[model samples]
Target: MQTEIIVAGFGGQGVLFAGQVLAYAAMDHGLHVTWIPSYGPEMRGGTANCTVIIADEEIGAPLVKHPKAVIALNRPSLDKYEPLVTAGGLLLVNASLIDRPVAREDVQAVYVPANEIAERLGDKRLTNMVMVGALLGATGVLEMNAVQESLKAHLPAKHHRLLPANYQALEEGAQIARETLAQAA
Candidate 1:
């Protein structure tokens, strides 16, 4: 199985970090993974997107022109990357920031209030984790428990104490996904 994902948003939205964590989690699951980030001037308030490729076999390319999944944290991200997602793939949008919905029918568009959830969790920085949760729940790429374990491995020693918060954020995001999907169904 091959999974390509693009996490795109503004510069400070942790788009790159989200890709890194997903890549790391894929690697931990014994899959080949590659992460590519658009940096420098392109990251300044514009569409800062990172591509993560995970495959059971060798990955041919790291750049994802068309991804199997897209996590768009902002309106610009959705407007920019929504078309690139493959048919029957997954699209996770930050509903808190985007007003319009995806018009595509081939893919599943999941709306998650990641930023709002992070704010309610008392640390807006956990928006990335919240999106991670939605991604996990929507695509079943990684188990929730495995994601929690990966968080411990990914966070630095200085920020180790915040592991609990991140875990909670992820769980909350996943729960939101579940509820939203249920309502949509």
Candidate 2:
């Protein structure tokens, strides 16, 4: 299987980190993976995005012009990448930050209130984790267990204490995505 995904948001939203986790998860599952990140000059509020490709065989390129799936964490991100998702692809939007609805009809759009959910979970930083979970749920590109394992492997030892919170955020996002899918069906 081959999956191309784009994750985008402002800096400090963990867009790059989310891509890293997804790439690591793909690697742990023995899949060929590539992750490419881009960001503006400003560190905190600048736009940041990453493209990740996971495949069962060798990957031809690291850049993704049109992705099969997208995780857009803000209105600007959604506006920028929503049109780039291929037809019949998946689009996971962070509803809490993006007030507008998706306009596409061909692709699956799963809206998760990532920021609000993360706030409820007591850590706003887990918003990206929530989006990651929704992406995994909507695309089935990676298992939750694989993502959890990836977190353990990629996160610094000093940050191990936050694993449980991240796990919770992931599960919450997955649940939201599943509910959206069910409603759509």
Candidate 3:
């Protein structure tokens, strides 16, 4: 199983962190993975993005021209990355920050209210976690248990208190996807 994903947004939106968490989950799943982040001038600004590859075999390239999934956190990100999603891929957008719809029928696009959900959870910074949850629920790439464990390992010790809240954010995200998709179906 090979899956390529792009997570992109402005700098302060935690796009990289979301990629890192997904990468960590892939690692914990014992899959060969590579995380290639956009470097140089783009990193200086909030326009951060990364490509993550998880596969059962050696990855041929780290640069993804087409990805199996996309987590777009802003309008610019959605505009830039939405076209790159492959047929039957997943696109999880931060609907709270971006109010656009995917223009492709080849992909399954899910709009997540990350900022609103995070705020409701009492932290406006768990947007990444919210995206994480939607990604998991939408794609089923990793087990929820693996994600929780990865969070525990990836988060700093001082921020242990956030583990539960982060988990909550993730669950809320999943629920949102479940409810919305169910309704659509």
Candidate 2 overall Cα lDDT vs. reference? 0.91
lDDT of 1 by residue, 15-100 (tens): 88888888888888888999989746766656688888888899998886789999999998899888888888888999988999
Give one digit per residue, the lDDT tens place, for model 3 in 70-124.
8998999899888888888888989998977888887788989899999999998
TM-score of 3: 0.94
Candidate 2: residue 44 Cα off by (Å): 11
Off by over 4 Å in 1: 39-41
**Candidate 2 regions off by >4 Å?**
39-45
lDDT of candidate 2 over 24-113, digit per residue (tens): 999998999999886445335588999999999999988877899999988999998888899998999999989999999999999999
Whole-model Cα lDDT per candidate?
0.86, 0.91, 0.87
Selected candidate, larger TM-score, 2 vs 3: 2
RMSD of candidate 1 to true structure, Å = 1.6
Candidate 3 total steric clashes? 2
- Candidate 2: pairs in clash: none
Total clashes in model 1, counting residue pairs 3 or more apart in sequence or in different chains: 0
TM-score each candidate. Answer: 0.93, 0.95, 0.94
